[model samples]
Target: MRLGECRQLRVKDMDVERRQILARDGRGQKDRITLLPEKAVTILR
Candidate 1:
């Protein structure tokens, strides 16, 4: 993901059970869903 996307992430954007992240205002000003890297799970929690 881009640095901007990461910076915009909020706690509510995380779906830990599904290991997903909702990236808002992304490319073309559209929203998208992306997989959360397994390595980041623990840190995010």
Candidate 2:
């Protein structure tokens, strides 16, 4: 994800069960889907 979008992330943006991140206000000022890797998920938790 772009730095700006990542900065805007909220708890609601992370879907742990589905293992995905909802990247809002992205590089082009759009929302997009990004993956949440298994390793990262464990770490985040």
lDDT of each: 0.93, 0.90
**Model 1 quality (TM-score):** 0.84
lDDT of 1 by residue, 1-45 (tens): 888999999999999889999999998999999999898898877
TM-score winner among the candidates? Answer: 1
Give Cα distance to truth, residue 20, candidate 2, Å. Answer: 0.5
Per candidate, the number of residue pairs that clash is 0, 0
TM-score of each: 0.84, 0.83
State residue 19's C-alpha deviation in candidate 1, in Å.
0.4
Alpha carbon lDDT at 23, candidate 2: 96
What is the number of residue pairs that collide in model 1?
0
